[model samples]
Target: MLLEVKNLNTYYGESHVLQDMALSVDEGELVALLGRNGMGKSTALKSIMGLVKPKSGTVRFKDKDIAGYPPYKVARAGIGYVPEERRIFPNLPVLDNLAIGIKGGKIDAGNPDAWTVDRVFKHFPALKARSGQKGSHLSGGEQQMLAIGRSLMGNPELIMVDEPTEGLAPFLVMEVRDMLKDINKVGVSILFVEHNLKVAMSLAHRLYLMGKACLAFTGTVEELDAQPEIRAKYLEV
Candidate 1:
């Protein structure tokens, strides 16, 4: 497994947010974490990336235990995270924003590639066209694209994305989804937390439903698609 999270528990002050959450991802796979709002899906991603310190559990990446490491250490260990809010440097130019996120390392060019600025530009041409523009000047979709592109510059083996498709037009959502598919095609494993079932089903090979701060069910996308009752019980508003 490229990423393995086991029996993870996290808290925010007095509230327990993630309870015994566990999941795994292999190389080149796109896995979805699904649930309604306030189910700890984003917390799980934060815990893995070391933004939220877990009370207990193991987070193993590439066979190294990184349970309580800092966020910078996690990034250095080859994990890239795109938070739910598209957090880009608003004052910085597009190219500078991407350049700041770059971490120097050996990139695999032959297969399962690592991203360069050129490759990132190819994936998001709008960013290329607006390389000189400030991040605050871009559209919502463009900011989202820049967010993903910034993460890619780190050359991570795994990317954990939270709510990549939220608050976008249908056309922009489709474009971002396709961009994620293209990135996954090159063998980078993805752990995505998403509320959009249609997008999750279309993109993920495996599905994990979260509820009450724990994983309720996990299986292939086909299995999840067949369980309408599960959807209505846990996912429907």
Candidate 2:
């Protein structure tokens, strides 16, 4: 496994948000963490990124235990996170925002080729055109692209993206989905947290359904489509 998370738990003060969450991702695979709102999916991603400290559990990346490491340390462990909020620096130019997140280090021998600004721009040509434009001026789709581009500048081996399609137009959502597929084709393992079932089914090789702070289902897309009871019980609004 490129990334293995075992028995992970996290809390926000008095509230326990994640309970024994476990998942794994291998090189070149795109896995979906699917759930409705407020079901600990984003918290699981945060715990992996070290934005929210896990109370207990093991986060192993490339055979090294990285649980409880700080955010920068987690980033250094070859994990990159694109948050659902699209945390772009509004005053900064698009190119500069990406430049800010770039880190220099030796590339992992087993991972895909590292990402460069030019390479990321190729994946997102709209960002290329807006390179000199301020982030505050871009549309929601463009800002989301910049967010992903910035994370790629770090050259992470595993990427955890939260809600890449949220609030995007249907066309732009499809575009982002394709972009993620292209990224995976280049061998970066992906752990995607998304609420859009259609997008999730289209992009993910496997699906993990989360509920009440625990994993409720794990299966292929075809298997999930066949389980109407699972959908009605956990996914239907």
Candidate 3:
């Protein structure tokens, strides 16, 4: 497995946000975490990335315990994260945004497939045109692309994205989905939180549904289709 979480629990002050959460993403796999709002879907990704420290459990990445490690440490272990908000510097140009994500020695010069700013621009042609544009000046979809591109600048083995398609136009949604698929094709494992069932079903090799602070179900897309009750109760609006 590229990443694994077992019995993870996290708290936000007085309230428990995640309870006994467990999930894993194998190499070259695209795993989706599905759920409605307030069920710890985003929190799960945050915990694994060490953005929010887990109160307990084990997070093993590439066969080493990473739970409770600082966010930078988790990132140094070759994991990247793109928040739902797409937190790019509004005043910074696209190239500068991409440049800051570089982790000194992370990019292996010997690896032909390793990521670089030009590679990112090639993957996101729209971003290429806007390479000199300020982040706030780009459209929502472009910002999302920038966020993903910035993470790629880290040359991570796996990436965790939160609510990637929320509030996007249908075309933009498809664009984001295609970008993710292309990234996966290049051998980056992905663990993404998405509320859109159609996107999850169409994109993932496996799915984990969160409900009431824990994982309620996990299976293939066909298996999810086989259990409509689980979908209606946990996924449907």
Candidate 4:
């Protein structure tokens, strides 16, 4: 497995947000973490990224145990995170936003098909036009593209994205979906936290549905489609 998270337990102050969560992504795979609001989807991503420290768990990446490591350490471990909030620097230009994501100028040999600013521009041509524009000037879709592009600049073996297509037009959502497909084609494994079932159904090679602080279902997209009850019980609002 490229990334394996086993028996993950996390909390927010006193609330038990994640309970023994476990999932895995093989190299070059695009796996979707599906769930409704407030059901530990983002929390699971944070726990893996070391943004929210887990009380106990084993996060193994490329045969190495990385649990409890700091955020920088986790990033250095070939994991890049794109938060749901799209936390780009407002005053910085689009190029600068992408520039900061380069890990010590480049990634190691883990990601053979690495990303550079020019490569990012190819994936997101809109960004090239806005390269000199400040972050605050871009539209929501443009900002989202920038966010994904920035994370790609790190050249991580696995990239975890939170709510990537949330709050966007249908056309823009489809655009992002194609963008993700292109990224996955280059051998970067993906663990995506998505609320949009239709979107996830279209892209993911495998699906993991989370509910009530635990994994509710794990299967392929066809398997998920075959189980309407599972969708009604855990996925449908």
- Candidate with the greatest TM-score versus the true structure: 3
Predicted structure 4: lDDT? 0.92
C-alpha displacement of 208 in model 4, angstroms?
0.6
lDDT of 4 at 93: 99
- C-alpha lDDT score of every prediction, in listed order: 0.90, 0.89, 0.92, 0.92
Q: Candidate 4's residue-wise lDDT over 42-159, tens digit each?
A: 9998998889999999999999999899999999999999999999999999999998999886554575466888899999998899999999999889999999999888878889
* Candidate 2 Cα misplacement greater than 4 A, ranges: 104-112
Worst 10 residues of 4 by lDDT: 105-114
Q: How would you encode candidate 2's per-residue C-alpha lDDT over 107-127 as one tens digit per residue?
A: 334545767778899999988
Candidate 3 residues lying further than 4 Å off, grouped into runs, are 105-107
Across residues 182-225, which tens digit of lDDT does each residue of candidate 1 receive? 98997678999888899999999999999798988899988987
| Native-structure RMSD, model 2 | 2.3
Q: How does each model score on TM-score?
A: 0.95, 0.95, 0.97, 0.96
Of 2 and 4, the candidate ahead on lDDT is 4
Better of 1 and 4 by lDDT: 4
